[model samples]
Target: MKRRVAITGVGLIDPLNESINNFFARTIRGESSIRYFASKGDPVPVSIPAVYCADFKGDDLLGKHRTISMDRFSQMGLVAAFDAWTNAGFNVHDRSHKPNAGVSWGTALGGTRIYEQGLREMWINGRERLPPLSVVMGMNNACSSHIAIQLGLGNSSLTYSVACSSASAAIGEAYKRIRNGEANIMVTGGSDTPLIYGVIRAWDGMRVLSPGNEENSPSACRPFDKSRSGLVLGEGAAALVLEDWDHAILRGARILAELAGYGANCDHVNLVKPDSSGQAAAISLALEDAGIPPKDVGYVNAHGTATIEGDPSEIEALRSVFGRQAKELAVSSTKSTHGHLMGASGAVEAVITVLCLKNSIVPPTANLKDIDTSCEGVRHIRIGDSNKSDLKAAISNSFAFGGSNAVLVFKST
Candidate 1:
């Protein structure tokens, strides 16, 4: 028999707030974290509205010496992983390696900020002027490597870069390893700091970013709404501590929820566009993995990026999976408030999904004033909170740019 997995702890370094309680409270209030900013030191000047982690101080989480050599993305991941470790009642500085513990992290644009700065220094100045640790700081696996080193996890350390589904894939892969008896515990999630000048300029060229008006910048990301324009890029990291159910019970750890199932697939059709059939297949596969049917899931955390095509495609996928019951399923996209965190979105949303199961309350999809006709049937959680005493299970969906999709099923513990 497969071992059961329990999500014992979770952590976040998001734009809304660092503390989980504070973040959930702000989410319940439907507050938007999107803001506008002007570019600095670029060949061409640009202005755009995006979600940024303005309050995160790396030195505060990691000492000044440790953070000096770490990139912003790696720093965020380390902070979040440390938070999860502490929250799980483990000492952050305990370097005593656990034989069965490992790490799996994901990132799409890893260390972009440091890479951009390195290029700028090389171009504007001389080759010798570049930072000495530039290569180490800009590597894609730097975050996961740093996390494993800090936590003394020696079993395995892996990284995934499946665009938007990166984090979800990491967590899902970790879940499988534990269930298959390869490890007893895993530190898993994703992180990305893509708000750098070059990264934002690339996204700007794609024309998928929200064009916010100066008067109402906070309301720019309106997922599933009729006036929804596009996604707002955000930066952050989220981490979770997944343990074997028996191991958690043996240690008397507090169980937040059970990771009952995970499903991942590729659209194989378009790079930027979503395929409804592919999404539906992933959802069905997750349900099958969990040994549950469609009617058993009470809530869905959507991959609603608020783009014109993205929202409708997700709605169609839900319709295909839930059939007539789609009209009654409580669905919401927290991106409506926190903006899209890119690679870290799935991990953050998974934390939110587990919280929803534990608290029995569904967070509102902020800024959804008018639901589009194409997204009408599904019951979109709007402006106010909805409490369901019988809420038993929830699914968090993540669809990425490479046509990759990942869905995670969480159940009340």
Candidate 2:
């Protein structure tokens, strides 16, 4: 029999709200975190407005690790993991759970901030690079190892980088390990703070970003809308404490939700685009693994990044997977509120979706004036305001740059 894995605790550090409760409350109330991106002169090309964390104190969580030449991504990961560990009522530094726990984190880019800094130093010193810690601290696995060392897991500490699906894949892989009796507990999630100039320039090069009025704030991202342009850049981290069902109950832990199923696939046909049929297969594979019929799903947390290709492609995938039942399902994109958090997007959204299911409240897709025509069957919650309630379950989708797709099925514990 397959082992059961449950989400004992979850935490989010996003642009809208840092705490989970505050974040969901504000999100459900039709709030938008999208704000004007200050024109900080060159390097930060094209006053590309973005949504950033309102109250992030990475320095406070940095401590000894802060001086280790870590970058912004590592800092976000450490802070988020620490907060999630504490929220789950587990003292990460405590010996009680350290030995049995592990750290498997994910991110699109690790230490982008430090990489930029390192490159600058190299130029200033005429390419005579110094400090062996440059690559070590700037490495992508730095965040995962940081969490592992800080908490002293002394076990498997792996970092998976699959573009946007990095965190979702991390959580799914973590679940697989625990379900297979690898560990009793695992601290898994993702973080990314690569709002650096290089990343944006790279994104712009693809023409995937919305060319609308960056000054208007909301013009950047508008999922499921007729005038939807492109996804807005967002930064933050979200972490979850994944524990065995029996282990959580033994410790009297507050069981939030059961991670019933996880599925992933790659559209091998394309590098940056998805094959229509293959994308749908990924969603179906997830439901099949969950052992739940399509009719069982009440809500869906879409990977709606508001891109011209992303939103409709995902809608089609859902329709193909869920068939006629898709029409009755309530599907909302939390990205409408939080923007695209890149690496951390899927994990944070899963938390939001799980909370919505627990409270029976579905977060609406804000700023969606008109739902697109091609994407039918999926019900969009365009409520004017919101409140807290419980729900049965929530489905989160994460597709990355290279057609890397991940889907997760979650239910209340």
Candidate 3:
């Protein structure tokens, strides 16, 4: 028998370090956290616009002993996971074995910062060896393993590293686990710390890193606009607690939203460029999985990286799927405000989408001035616009570099 999955809790580490309520409120207000980042006194200095959680002190949150051997990405993921567990009404102090719960996480460049530091120590500082815990901390599965260990989840501990689609794919798989009765609860999300020197240099080489001065850095990520540039890299994490509907009901958990459907597929046409046909197929499959029609999906949290090719391609996919209904569909890209969180983007955007359904208010695409003609099929939610639409369902889109696409359909419970 197929069971239903419900989202009982959500958590994240963003630039504000604020509560989830404040984060959602600020996002709806179209506020941007991006700032100018310039590396000084380095062998190769790079300047760009990015979002960093300057106030996040993992040691303070997770304590020194617990975070002693974890990498920055692992620390961020564990913090978010613990917050989600507590928010879901689970006792963090009760670390008893739970054979019915598990963890699924994702990251594109897990522990890249740690590896970079080790390389610098060996090549530049003449160090003979890295820290003893470097291998354990730098593993991509470290975060998920830590979560399972701390919570005593014994069903499964899995990790996915599919670039930008990592988190969405993780969340989707967790939903499937609960839907298929494989587990009663699952902690799922993704995190990435991509603001490192080498990471930025590589993205800069690709010419996809948007440029900005100190004054305009906040508006550097302008998606679907005539003057839109490219993506701004950000560092953060987001997590969700998925539970079986009956289990949540038995426990009297406050259900946030229903994770109704998930569809994932490979474009297979290009390594970096997006194909609209593949994207449309994924969207159609997700809607079909949810037993929902195109006209019923009220809003879309677009994976709008503001690149020249990505924005129009996403809009074209929507046009092909929804046809005339696309004209009235509300669409916005929260990346305009939060910047892109790389592998973690999908999880953070999914949280925002769930909030939209709960509050019946859609957030506008921050800094969107004029929509490009190719991206004008839908009702573009722009800054300063009233967004209090009564929405029943919404979808979050995540398209990654290796032609991986994942779409999540969520409905108000």
The candidate that achieves the highest TM-score relative to the unseen native structure? 3
Off by over 4 Å in 1: 16-18, 127-129
Q: Assess each prediction's global lDDT (C-alpha) against the native.
A: 0.89, 0.80, 0.93
Clashes of 1: 0
Residue runs of model 3 more than 4 Å from their true location after superposition: none
- In TM-score terms, candidate 2 sits at 0.94
Tens digit per residue, CA lDDT, model 2, 1-413: 78899888887776754567888888787687878664344444565657777566666657754756677777777878888888888886697666778988889888776777667668755677657887877889998998888888866898999999999999999988898899889999999875777777888788777654545786457888988888888888889989999999998998878898888999888888766577788778888888888888888888888887778898998888888888877888878777787888887887887787777788888888888896666777786634333556667889888888888889875
Off by over 4 Å in 2: 16-18, 39-44, 64-67, 124-127, 212-215, 385-390
State, as a TM-score between 0 and 1, how close model 3 is to the true structure.
0.99
lDDT of 3 by residue, 373-411 (tens): 989989999978879988888999999999999999999
| lDDT, residue 91, model 3 | 85
RMSD of 1: 1.3
**Clashing pairs counted in every model:** 0, 8, 0
Rank the models by lDDT, top first. Answer: 3, 1, 2
> Using Cα atoms with residue i matched to residue i, what is each candidate's TM-score against the true structure?
0.97, 0.94, 0.99
Worst 10 residues of 1 by lDDT: 383-392
